[model samples]
Target: MKKLFHIGEYFQEKYSQPLQRIGIDLALGCPHRSNGGFGDGCIFCTEDGARARHLTRVGLNLVEQVACGIEYVKKRYGENVGLIAYFQSFTSTNAPVSRLRELYSLVLSQADFKVVIVSTRPDALPDEVLDYLEELNEKYELFVELGIQSACDRTLQEINRGHDFAAVKNACARLKKRNLKVAGHFILGLPGEDFNDWMYTADQAAALQLDAVKIHQLMVLKNTVLAQRCNQNSNYVKPLNEYDYAAALKSFLQRLPENTLLMRLMGDAPESELISPRWWMKKGQFLSFFKEYFYSDNTQNGNFVLTHTADGTPTLYHPRYRQHFHSLAGAGSEAEKKFAEPSALPERLQKSASEKRPLRLLDIGFGLGGNSFAALAHSEKVSGCALEITALEFDLRTLQAALNLYNPNSKEFNILQELINNGFCRCGNSEIKLLLDDARNTIRKLPEKSFDLLWLDAFSSDVNPELWSQHFFAECFRVMRNDGALLTYSSAPTVRGGLFKAGFTVGETPSFGRKRSGSIAFINMPQEGFVPLSEKEKHIIFDSTAGVPYSDCSLNAAPEKILSQHKKLVERLRRRGVPKWYREKTVKN
Candidate 1:
């Protein structure tokens, strides 16, 4: 047998450790469907109904799943073992940027996770996601594995893969441009192909200049089109028996370039899910056999750098935004104090049941869902009325990311998981609604004056000025009940100005986060727990250019347009004489 270069040895030499990759099903699921207009997924794929896996959280939550894998590794490899967070199964890059960040962050937050392996499809590598990945690669060694399946165009089409070889080539090029370690996935012994075809696939793969390559014996699984064909005519779908498969894989391996890192040699599914040659080989047993057959085993790249705060909860440093998603004080604490408490949402929600009215809620910019989750945690205290929540978010992918944090064992997560998948979560009388689009556009779709509470938890005004624009506030004011209260962590002069100008009676709540006090607004003045704005604050809101608030004229305009309009207004103000109440800083600017 010709000896093949082992990936395990190469990774061990580089990382100076016996590294292992812990595969966690991201549940992003493949976008290509058999019935969808675009195209069906591969004929051998058994990932039916997995794209929205966030909705149907099968088995353990991602974190728990990782923990389980970690324990198993510890038992085998002993303690102090670091592992790569391998995002396996489905197309990992299928969600929004927000979601991708959250998903990546989950692994990065845990100290044991040192490297990340992003497994995605060749056709799904959009420029936006690539850009984000490039930014992440600066902080962490990131490896991107593209599922090429087979290099031949005919084989690709026969498998119902939406894209062709050209697309895969372009995607590999883009990843290489970002200087990311690229891995190409291929399958040996695909139907209607002989050893010569495998050689062709190997040649095509080598030409791509990939850092690594992964190939597994093709197995027809249950419910797959191939499985049905195999049932009808076993000869038509001639899967290599164990002995034949080992020989074919060896042939393909010898043909592959020497420099390529062999990521995977074989793939397997659960016995129940598989309808194959019935070779019940454990992954370890197969790997051991492979080492004796040729050689191998291994683990690099991370995305977010996690920093622990006073409360011990870690915060994720966002690479693109160059900011922390949570407060420096602590993520969990900030969620409870800054967002949930000040809003008095728990109390209001409890009151809704007795009043026989659904507690309508509007959560703006549901980034990590900290605020909403905080409210739900609090709601466990008492029975609340049916919750009619309308959470507006630009990136719906975070739902998948957040859903992966807790296992199905958590009753709350189960409810929330259902909500994330289906755009609504139901538990008894409580109902949570999700609007997965830009808040500006989606806000209009909400019913008028229907919400009793609104949590304005978007990014900072400087980073996200459009959310604090007068137009957004006006729309928010329109959707809120007369007695409704809007709470936000922002106490910026611009934010207060926008709220005040939008016909809200703005007040200061308890101080938290990066501000002296959080903001609370009401259409009707609250009788208690509200403080009127001081003269100093009023001066900043009404007189200073700093308070010259943003305006999204059409409510659907981009942030750049809104900022451009604000700059023009400030210039017009500058053209006029400096007003008496204007700050010296405003006049100089």
Candidate 2:
């Protein structure tokens, strides 16, 4: 499964030990420098960004510096440490391929350097340079890092980045075609940009699918053009405080592709260099809080943890039930694929919503409201379509946790905040009502035959079986309109059996993504149009031991008690040799 990976963790696992990076200043300078491409670098960037300010004092060449950095690593970390030759100084690819080859070959010749990184502006990586880098990869691990700070052209101009977002896209695509490992470096808090702009940049970064990412709050360093700008406009640089940056990182992490290594969360800003946003805590101290923060608030929120699934969407993991709110494939995509699309909900609701009366939707076991929000994304824009959503949630804390974890700039953040601030959220004609009580009891109180679309998003049958019982399904059947369709992500026999018993004409939810088939039931679905469940699944629902469904008649029975009741029914059925498919009919014997 894909996960949020730290650079240190990824390297340690790959190399059998942590690999330290040796910062090597090639002194190659940048294409965007005064003598080359654009105006004097980015407004905020100094030579410190390319090569350390003190690097010229050492007066060491690339190979000599790699040797010295290796010795420094040996003293600092341990002996015989694996080192990555990080060509951090300026644009490593500014030179011709011949000179670039010579410098990179010298660095790779060192026995301890297992990998060499080339950090350069996207505009500097021409096709010829990429071809050369591709060839170099066969001999040594090479990562071509790009500084694509902003996706917006306006933002790029403001920063004096000297290249448009298209150049970054073209360069990354060129490198990707050569199967090169690439990382994009992003700096937040650029001048005249809001949180929305930052979100746009992060989304664009994720779309690149870079091998890794380096995200940091922009540091206002001394003796830079940004300083003068900041001085002129007091609001030019609004630094991120602890919560601000932490929240910002969470938002970026949420959008990041699965398995992309986080190269750095904060910059290596020396105390003597940084101008502001200091004094509260050092970077290390903030990281300690950042590491602990992911775990701390979840304690009050029912053991709910945030984890990314295979497709890079953030999902909620319930440690108590050991269940994930989304599929291992993905969270958002899974909901849209397995739940929303399978039901043809978008089309149906759009039509229903445009009618004189609004469509009514029932969301069972609304954990963090992913399904509701996804459905809303499609239905909210329908002309004249009004919606009434009645959602049943046993634990409100999960929603609270989502608010704490998600970036406030995210749509989910706004949606969740709206739900928390008000008991419900209304978009156009759609209205949602959240129920805090147990669904088994609360669902029964909803108006009968009121819902046009039902999202049966209850917990897994065996894991949290109370909501999957015959009684609960009957209540769902009672509440759904004659034209209503109920969609569920599970095709489990137990769940199917309950739906069948509740008088729903069971059908198969169409295959999507990695999942083949989900379950859906229509109040009066014709067999001609929709996909039907196969004979094997139907037979299992009718005859298999797993077909013994849970039944909580009182609507308040504990899960253990409900299972015991179902066990007795299964025993009785087995003794009677019912469900003829499971019974023996021996004549000659």
Candidate 3:
């Protein structure tokens, strides 16, 4: 069997003693031309791969590069292990086969190193190079990172990638045939690309059977062609809003193949080098914003899918709900009602003493620390024990905002900050720690069957179909303790069906505010009083028309196809005596 080493795994093994990464520049030219090709390389390409010059040094050969990488790794990680030689600059494999072999051999000569990763363009790989890479696979771990910004050719050409879609497909096929591990790179929010394009790219990567994938938001760097274009026409560059980026990422991860390793969900660009989309320059703050927005109790991105056209273009599916929600939040009346009451609290703990054990909670979105604050407020009246909160958010800006809002002067804020800062925070009189980043990405990293209460607040279902899918819910089921409960504000029947499919016993809990209906709650295992699905409901389970076979997190799959499949299931259920609620009401009318 061929041994596969992921770039991340290689780095982890090499720097096992600590967290450190080194970027090595190959300085190889493009194959299309002896001189550099047109359009100044892809719009997103940067001179240093966005690394600081002072932090990195240039090397002429593979030996010097490896040595420089090693020196940096040692300095940062204290030499307990080896180094990960990252071939980052330009296309590492755009040279002759003989030259490629020689350079690879030089890097492998450093026996202390754990792995050597080559980041190259898909079109640059040749058969002879593959043979050499296979040979290197036997001695040292090898990972090939391929840049495939988007599956859409129009978007590809818009960025001047210089290769067609066929090139990426062919290269991936060749790499897979060799049993070599492949990592795909995608940039979200590129010029002329929107959420649909991003979803399509993710679906394509998933369909391509990639071993791993890394996603980066499009950053307009100073001195780049993209920046020049933006300067020429202010409207040429369209940057993603902080909310949009987080929602897009959440949906993207949901569609990703289950087994594929996500090397990165976002990347950092130096604020000084960034020219447009000033929001992205505040990478930390942007992430924090995403974290907080997604971490609330009842948010999911379901609406994103609804807003997208059958062909992946943005459209307004239902303007009424958007208006309704905005009005609700703006009125303050609904917001106060929804937030004033504690909806997900267990009956036993509803009236518990302040000295009781701290509530063990799991927060899915963790957007801006608002949910955490709410939890803290509820905990104050209940018990002094540890809150044991684990929150997940995909954006870095929201997390930074949370950190900033964490006041050292205020006792409550200080305690929250300390928990986040110390990796885990034990409240002065309680225990509560906040886990940062995307929930779906971070779910498996958590201790199995550990959470007592879970908050499933993400974007609306329209915005994030991946998070609302059956697979994500299944993972949620795996992580929750037997008696654990999950709470979310979504009242959509399809969302509830997904939770049911994931093995949770679902029902409605009291609403937070003046809404006539309550939010949804699911138990890891059904409670004694919980109602079993009626015969009609069971028919809905098998009713092809009612729900669709859930799509994994790949963006390439057509939503219409999935929805069609779901329609078929619903039709089957209808034939099986599943009475429609609307039909019944119509008959009465």
Q: Which candidate gets the maximum lDDT versus the true structure?
A: 2
> Tens digit of lDDT per residue, candidate 3, span 288-387?
5444444432133333212221233222111212222212222223222333243345342453334365456777766545556566665666543356
TM-score of each: 0.48, 0.51, 0.49
lDDT of 2 by residue, 1-589 (tens): 1355898898888889878888877778888878563337888877555574444456977667767777778899998578888888778888998888887777778755777788999989877888888887886688988998888899899988888999999988988989999999988778777788888988988899889998888888888899888888888878775556665676677787888988888765677877866735567866776676543644576656565667877776675465678776777787788777776766776677556787778888788788888877777656777767888888778788777557889877887777777877776667778888888879878889888878888777777888888788898999988888888877777788998998888888776554557888888854235788877777778876667778888888999888788878877887887562444347995
Among residues 3 or more apart in sequence or in different chains, the pairs in candidate 2 whose N, CA or C atoms overlap within 3 Å are 50-89, 50-90, 353-385
After TM-score superposition, what is the CA distance of residue 191 in candidate 1 from its true location, in Å?
55
List per-prediction Cα lDDT, in the order shown: 0.73, 0.78, 0.62
Across residues 1-589, which tens digit of lDDT does each residue of candidate 1 receive? 2466566777777778877777677667676763432234678876543232222255767677677677777888877566877777678888888898897778567645657788888878888899888887887667899989887888888777878999999998888988988988888767777878887887778778888888788877888888877788877666654445555676676666676787788877768877775653467766665554443210000222244445776544443344566776787798778767777777787788789888777889776566777776666566755666677877655554454445669764675577667878765656667788878888888889998889998878776777899888999999999989999888888888899889999988887655588889999857367788887788878877767778887877767777788878878886785353455455553
Candidate that scores best on TM-score: 2
For residue 201, model 1's alpha carbon misses the true position, in angstroms, by 34
Query: For model 3, where is the 10-residue window of minimal lDDT?
Result: 317-326
Number of clashes recorded per candidate: 10, 3, 73
